[model samples]
Target: MEGSNEELNPNAMTAEQTAALFSKLRRRRVSVAEVEADIEAGAPTNDAGRLNLLTYTAWMLKEAGRGE
Candidate 1:
């Protein structure tokens, strides 16, 4: 599932990479802006401005459980 020249690091992906990776996994179109919005909404990202798949997924699941 290596779509780009640079191997995607699931533990530390840029928003675009994250969106692309997730869109593939989910079989749906996930936009980079949406990922960026998630970061703005407090989805956790590493200090290097990269997202960890597990952490981000956990945050999303937690948010969903909140039912807000």
Candidate 2:
């Protein structure tokens, strides 16, 4: 049987949750190279721009974690 949405996603974060996380990362000022790596690894095909943004956000999160 297919899992319910909650079961499929234990964290149950919404798009708003994703956006908030991205926003925090943006405030950290991550580097472009790191963002490119994340884009290569995480985003779906033909979604270069979205992936780029998400990757950049992820990089920012990492940088923020390091206090950069």
Candidate 3:
């Protein structure tokens, strides 16, 4: 997967081009607080969103050494 991502990378960049290829995605990046608030509010209304919230929380706990 990383190979495919790198294959399309330009030869010159600020790590891969002076400008961001996916600027819109970069701009809309969510904050941890927002996800927590959404989860608390049951905002997803879908399985995927719930899964992502759980996964993100799990990862966070794991990184903080609070998860088994």
Q: Please list the C-alpha lDDT of all candidates, in the order they appear.
A: 0.90, 0.43, 0.38
Ranking by lDDT: 1, 2, 3
Give the TM-score comparing model 2 with the true structure, all chains together. 0.28
lDDT per residue for candidate 1 within 4-64, as digits (tens), equals 6888788998999888888998999999999999999999988998999999999999988
> What's the TM-score of each model vs. the native?
0.89, 0.28, 0.27
At residue 59, give the lDDT of candidate 1: 96
Q: Name the regions of candidate 3 deviating beyond 4 angstroms.
A: 1-26, 44-68
**Candidate whose lDDT is highest:** 1
After superposing candidate 2, which stretches have Cα over 4 Å from the reference? 1-25, 45-68
Model 2 scores worst on lDDT over the 10 consecutive residues at 1-10
In the range 1-68, model 2's lDDT, one tens digit per residue, is: 12333322213323333444445646863444544454565533233244333444455577568764
What is the lDDT, from 0 to 100, of the residue 49 in candidate 2?
47
Residue pairs with colliding backbones in model 2 are: none
Best by TM-score: 1
In the order shown, what is each candidate's alpha-carbon RMSD?
1.6, 10.4, 14.4
Provide the lDDT at 3 for model 1. 48
